[model samples]
Target: MRIATYNVNGVNGRLPVLLRWLAETRPDIVCLQELKAPSEKFPAQAIADAGYEAIWHGQKSWNGVAILSRVGTPVETRRGLPDDPDPSQSRYLEAAVAGVLVGGLYLPNGNPRPGPKFDYKLAWFDAFIAHAAELLASGAPVILAGDYNVMPTELDVYKPERWTDDALFAPEVRARYASLRAQGWTDALRHLHPGETIYTFFDYFRNAYARNAGLRIDHLLLSPALAGRLTGAGVDREARGWDKTSDHAPTWIELSEQAPRTRSASGSRPSRAAKPA
Candidate 1:
């Protein structure tokens, strides 16, 4: 199976771009971030017309997330992280698509660091880490994919010196990311293309894309069960070149046919033929 993650920027304004990509790539499952649309305006019909079933958590003019399954409707798992009794933003969404538990998130950018925004980002990361620990203990095949907004290492950024003061490249942020991965979640792209300068997002400024100056903040983290099935992983750099596209590109991973079974909520094994829904 092929699963991909993309930050749409704005679902409505970029519907055509998204549809075109779906037509060209046809990923079995896709995790989308930055919908920037309210729940009622998610364009579900347009997505269905493109031959995908989706579940989304949306907010007006800001953060949002969704999971699209080309084969079936993804079963809703959760809407937000557990500890947040009242999350005002739509940043995380989880669902079961083709037996894999997919957690799609749009982590905070935490710009202009050393302030409340930066503190909030760190707090949210802590909540995510706590929930991730629970998922790890469950032993279910899981994937945490999306724009993490943190460049985990110098290797993930271009001209590391230039971003020394940027929140995305902050040492504290990177450390938290490392702490999460240290829990056994494999960073898929890095696992497949170690030490390579693979990038998935480029700033619209400075002609970043044309200059190939980008960052690999977008990531796919696989649980131990799915990590073993990883056969290939890469960024769809061409997608970033498309007109009216999001600054981010689609990053995907492929799995072998002998993928291990995922434990379902009821403690039962999910079937291979159990198409998405």
Candidate 2:
């Protein structure tokens, strides 16, 4: 099965680009973030027409998340992180699609560090971590996919020195991200291309895409139960170059029907993907 994640920025404004990419790639499941629309204006019919059944949590003019599946209708699991610090914000959405529990999230963009927003970001991360532990304990095949709004390491940033003070790259945020990964969730893309300078998001301005100045913030983390089935992963960099596209591209992982007896570290390969753009 192929699963992908993309931060749409604004579902309504980016519908055309979203549909085009969906049609071209046709992933079995997709996790979308930053819908920036309300529950009533999600354009469900439009998405349905594109051959996907979706479940979404939306808020007005801000954060939102959704899971779309073409293989089967996603069975609703959770709407938001258990005890979300800011339940008012539509950030996390979880569902079961194609036999995998998919968790989609739009983590808070804790900008302007040393403020309530940043504090809330950490609190939310803690809540997510606690809930994730429960999920891991369940021993089910789970894939946590979305825009994490964090650069786990210096390697994930194009110019690490330039973003030291930024909330997304702040030491505290990175530490939390590392701790989450340490809990046994596999960072699928990094597992396939460990040393590659891969990025999933680029700033919309400053000609970031043209210069390949990007960050690998969006991710698809596989639970231990499904990690061995990972066979391929990559970022659809070309999608970012499309007309009026999102700054975030589609990041994906392909999983085999069953786990192998022994998975090789160098066995997985990336699918068709463009150079950083």
Candidate 3:
């Protein structure tokens, strides 16, 4: 199965580009971020016309997320982080598709550090990590995919020194990311390429895409149960050059078919005896 993540920036404005990519590179499952629309404005018909069924959590003008399934309707597991009882901004959506629990997140882009926004970013990370741990404990095959908004390492950015003070590259943010990984979530791209500098996002300014000066802030983290099925992972860098596209290019992974295991009636969780491909 092939799963991909793309931050559409503005889903309505980018519908055509989104449809084009959907046709050109048909991923079985897709996690979308930055919808920038209210729940009612999700363009359900257009997406349906493109042959994908979607479940989305949307907020007006910023930070929305969705999960799309090409094969069937994704059974929604949740809409927002449980830790936040009354979340006004949409930022997460989880669903089950093809037996995998997919968590789509649009992490905060805490630009100027040393402020409330930055503090919220860190707090959100903490709450997210706690929920992630809960998901891990459920023993379900899970994939957390989206624009994390945190550059985890020097290799993930074009110039480490320039980003030192930025919240995305702040030492504390990186440490939190490392802490999450220590819990056994595999960063798919890093696991596959190791030493390569792979970027999934490029700034619209300074001819960043042309210069190939980009950041790998978007990521797909796999739980231990699903990591071993990972066969390949990469970024569709060329997509960044598409007309009126989001800063983020599509990032994806391939997984070989695994032996079938007992599943719940909803096929949300695989049995413990399940083996990797």
Candidate 4:
């Protein structure tokens, strides 16, 4: 199976680019973030016309998340982070596609840190950690894919020194990300291309894509059980140059059909959360 994630920026504004990418890539499952469209304006029929069944959590002109599957209707497991007591923002959605539990997220881009926005960003990460803990406890083969707005390490970002104060590169933010991964989810792409130079997002204003100066913020993190199935992983950098394209490109991974069943690092049996299609 081929699973991919892309931050479309806005579904309606980038519909053409999105459709074209879908036609060309044909991933079995696609997780989208930042739809920036209300649920009523999701253009479900248009997506259905492209041969994918989808479930979305949308908000007007802001954060949103959705999952589209070619093999089956995605079963929505959750909409927002469970422990977020006041999560008025729509930034997450979980679903099941072809037996794989997938989560799509649009983490806050808390720029100009050391302020309220930055605080919220950290709080959001905390909530995500709680949710991730629950998923890990469930023991299902889960994949958390999206634009996490985090640069895992210096190698994950271009000119790391220049982003010292950036929320994405902050030590606290990186530590929180590490804590999430420490829960037993393998960073699929990094696992395949360990310490390799891979960039997934670029600054449109600075011609960053053309210069190959980008950050590996978009990711596919698989549970330890599902990691063995990963066959190939890549960033579709070309997609970032399409007309009205998003700053983040589509990142994807392919898995073999006959891979070994995934199990916890400790050899514990797996379990799953209930989902609704």
Candidate 5:
């Protein structure tokens, strides 16, 4: 299946670009982040009209997440990270599409480090790492996808030196990401195109896309079992240039149809599987 993830920036402001990409790419499942709209403000009818079913978690003028599936109803599994004791932002949403358990997350963009926001960002990452560990323990074929707001490695970002002090590139943030990956999750793009210069975000102010100077903060990480079935992966750079588009572009991976049929060590198909952004 063609599973894709995108941080649309704002659902209403970029409706046309969103629809156009949906029509052109026709991904079987899509995980959207940063809707920047409230639940009531979500344009559900408009999305449905484009031939997909959606389930979303939204907040006013800020972080939000949603999953749109073409094959099955998107059953909401969770709304926010359970470990978040003071959960106030709508940054996470989980759903089941066809049998895949997809999660859409908009991790905090903790700019201007050494501040309260940066602390919050690290706390959120800790919570996510804990939650991911729980999901991995479920022994499911999981696909955690989203704009993690993290430059995983120097290769993942252009001019890494300039971002050394940035929250996303800080040593602690990278360590957390590494800890999560150590739990058996595979960075799908890196797994397929190790060392390749692929980027999913560009700065409009700097005309970054034209210069191909961008960051690979967006990702689609899957479990080892599912990684073996990854047929291909890519970033849709054209989406960045689309009129009224978000700074972030769409990233996707194609999985072989035969992948899911393989039995796990427990001798049954995984109950939770995902391909979310």
Candidate 6:
């Protein structure tokens, strides 16, 4: 079974690219971030026509997320983070698909630090950490996949020194990501190919893809229950060069066929998140 995550940037504007990738790769399940469309605007019919079932939480022209499954109905378990510091942005979604509990998130791209946006990012991280701990304790097979936004280590960034002060590479954000790792969640790509120079995102500017200058911000972290089954992981780097494609290509993990079929822990609801309050 293969599971993938993508930061599509814009669902409507990139539908063709999205459909093409879906057709070509045919991952068993897909978690999509940056839908940038409201709930009513989600192209449900089109997605269904592509042989998948979807559940999404969307916000107008901003953060949004969804889960697509071809292997089973994506029975939604949660959507918004409980007590999210900002419940107005559509940043998180969770569901039980093909026997795995999947949590898809689009962490904030807090650009400049020492400001409100940066503070909000940290707060959101805190909430996510708390929620993740609960998920960990559930003892169910789980895969938390999406564009986490923050590049956790020097290995994850093209040039570490150049990103020192950027919110995505700042010490605080990296530490939060480390916390996730310490909690026993395995970063699938790095775990499988430990010294490899792998990247999931290339800048739309400066010929980044051509130069192989990119960031590995998109991830598929497996909970302890699902870690051992991970067999392969990779970035569809060539997709970044496709026309009208997102800066992010699909990042995925392949699991052994003997996956456990279990339900997910619940209680969060789906809602469009707004600006940080």
Highest TM-score: give the candidate number.
2
Question: What do the candidate models score in CA lDDT, each in turn?
Answer: 0.87, 0.91, 0.86, 0.85, 0.84, 0.87
Tens digit of lDDT per residue, candidate 4, span 51-126? 9999999998899899999999899989999877456788999998898999999888878799988888899999
Residue 20 error for model 4, in Å?
0.2
Residue 151, model 1, lDDT: 94
Candidate 1: Cα lDDT at 117: 87
Best by lDDT: 2
lDDT of 6 at 174: 94
Model 4 residue 39 CA deviation (Å) reads 0.7
Model 2 Cα lDDT, one tens digit per residue, 13-70:
9999999999999999999999999999998999999999999999899999999999
In model 4, where do residues sit more than 4 Å from their true spots?
260-277
Question: In what order do the candidates fall by lDDT, top score first?
Answer: 2, 1, 6, 3, 4, 5
Error of 1 at 141 (Å): 0.2
The RMSD of every model to the true structure, in order and in angstroms, is 7.0, 1.1, 7.0, 6.9, 5.7, 8.2
- Estimated TM-score per prediction? 0.92, 0.97, 0.92, 0.92, 0.92, 0.92
**CA shift of 154, model 4, Å:** 0.3
Cα lDDT tens digits, model 3, 173-250, are 999999999888999877867777778888999999888788899899999889777777878777788999999998
Tell me model 3's lDDT, rounded to 2 decimals.
Answer: 0.86
Clashes of 3: 0
Q: What range of 10 consecutive residues in model 1 has the weakest lDDT sum?
A: 268-277
Model 1 lDDT per residue over 1-277, tens place: 8899999899999999999999987999999999999999999999999899999999999999999998777999999998863399898999988889999999899888989888888888889999999999999999999999999998887799999989999989999999999999999888766656888899999999888788999999999989878877877787788889999988888876576454222232122111111
Tens digit per residue, CA lDDT, model 6, 1-277: 8899999999999999999999988989999999999999999999999999999999999989999999989999998998799998889999998889999999999977879999999999999999999999999999999999988889888888999889999999999999988998999877766666778888989988888888889988999888877767777777788998999989888787664353211211112111111
Q: Looking at model 6, which ten-residue stretch has the lowest summed lDDT? A: 268-277
Q: State each candidate's clash count.
A: 0, 0, 0, 1, 4, 5
